[model samples]
Target chain A: MQEIEELAARLRAFAEARDWEQFHTPKNLAMALAGETGELLAEFQWLTPEESATIMESPAGPRVRAELADVFSYLIRLADVLGVDLPQAAHAKIDENERRYDADAYRGSARKAPPLSGA
Target chain B: MQEIEELAARLRAFAEARDWEQFHTPKNLAMALAGETGELLAEFQWLTPEESATIMESPAGPRVRAELADVFSYLIRLADVLGVDLPQAAHAKIDENERRYDADAYRGSARKAPPLSGA
Candidate 1:
């Protein structure tokens, strides 16, 4: 979490130094994040599952890393601006997912567990 | 970084416990990451820039956090499976951005710097 905080600080300073904060509104950051996510997905477009697994070893590796970095930067900066703690939110979500999907019953299945009766 | 790495380990174990690793191919993860990114963007879809900035104090805040968590989870998992170190990649991109955009020259501008002559 410290690394994430530091990264957020750096992003803040970078934007402030350039007076870019006015342009980094949450809506803009969210849209930017989406754009980067699209770029990241484009890196894997048309690649077979097997090819995707080994993409890091291919000529596209550096580009993939750069795209991922772009996604992460916008995501982190958005979270920082919104006062969200990224790690804590993620951990809470994982806990919720564990409760939602019973491991023993859901083994080998990607399907969502059915809604509990009368819930 | 430890928090991210720990989250990745938890995600790996979660999938392993459910025998869902077979379903977690890189292509699938990338698509899932995109889906979550869309959900995150949806949280800000109808809000103006000012509304988006103050969203954290609104009722939509928790949902925004949850959507962000979803995006983070899939992204971390994707990077983990691809053997990319997320923080390092992000830091490198920030460094590149700093060099590419000179603060003094680009002050208050969001436009990207033009390509260097003749590379």
Candidate 2:
């Protein structure tokens, strides 16, 4: 958790050093995340079926990791500036899920959907 | 965007209906999310090579999507409860990525790692 915070701080410092805060508006950040995602996807774009799986840890792994990091960094930044506790929020959502996907219905079944109500 | 909010509202309603708020504490929710994640991974367990990639939209696809949604829903719920604007946070992260993975170093290259500094 502290690592998440430290990572966010490094990103902030990086942004400050570049004097790029003016472009850090929410809309721009979202668009950038989308674009980087595309870049991540691009790594897999045109690879043969075998290539796609093997691509990681070749030249592709680093790009994928970087893109993911990019996605995470600003997410943390926005959370920080907005005053959100990410772990706490992450925990709350899971509780709702247990009820939604009750274990009895899904535990041993290969099926993903819950059983139809009362059937 | 509005759809995201509406979905969050419905989840809250569902939570309220169950009177399960006592168990909705942060720790429980996280454990539930992790458990659901394991269920998702279970779908892929023991599948042949061909089975893994072609699994989507098959019996496996729905399970995968459901698990993904499970992961996402709580993520969104946490954001909603914390009043953090998700899209906004998502956007900001992208801006930071552009500089980190400059196009010149990676464009059209299979290599994912940026060039060695000053080379």
Candidate 3:
């Protein structure tokens, strides 16, 4: 796999080819990502519960898939700029989660945490 | 924020300290991410719609926050291994989205595509 930095370089090259650097500062990139996220959410805006669940698997999936790609793209860029190793961070976070949401208590329930102290 | 690869390196350092490489193959990492995603989804499960929306804003926010961190962690890892510059990818994808889900037809409705030609 290409390292994240290499990927960033490739992206820079692609952007340079198009003279798009002026548009890729962290703030603008972030704004673009938010806009794309909105579009991704919009894909399921009016759909029924069932439709929302299945939309990604349907012919219309392309649209939502594209939007999700948008989300990931910006997320990666954020990582690129910030120097975060996604895989390692992801793995480490899972380890932390194992502690907070032990499987024995968390399996098969939709609840996030155990009840509040009084409730 | 650090660059994605640097973050990966920092993560590697963290993992190495714990000798956790065996557990981080792409397959295992992916499974772990899915599991964590299930947990994040669980946070809102069983709660009334209002409860789910407010849960993140309440004391229980920490729990949901942790789960989200889990999701982003693995996602970053996957991107790291594959060498994708998330920020650039995100930016370009938004440009693509503008074409697919132009705002004029998409503003308030939740529908994805303009209705299918026949339906």
Name the best candidate (by lDDT): 1
Each prediction's TM-score versus the true structure: 0.93, 0.44, 0.49
Report lDDT (Cα) of residue B98, candidate 1. 81
Candidate 1 chain A weakest lDDT stretch, 10 residues? A110-119
Question: Which ranges in model 1 have alpha carbons more than 4 Å from their true place?
Answer: A113-119, B112-119
* DockQ of candidate 3 compared with the true complex: 0.08
Per-residue lDDT of candidate 1, residues B42-109 (tens digit): 88999999999999899999989998898888889899999999999988888887887888988876
Error of 2 at A12 (Å): 25
Best by TM-score: 1
Query: Which run of 10 residues does model 2 chain B get worst, by summed lDDT?
Result: B110-119
How much is the lDDT of residue A44 in candidate 3? Answer: 54
TM-score of 2: 0.44
Inter-residue clash pairs, candidate 1: none
TM-score (C-alpha) between model 1 and the true structure: 0.93
Q: What share of the true interface contacts does candidate 3 keep?
A: 0.09
Candidate 2, residues A1-119: lDDT per residue as tens digits?
35456655766665555444544543333334334434544555566545544444477555544544443454455445434454444434445555666655454332464221100
Specify the CAPRI tier of model 2. Answer: incorrect
Q: If ranked by DockQ, best first, what sequence of candidates would result?
A: 1, 3, 2
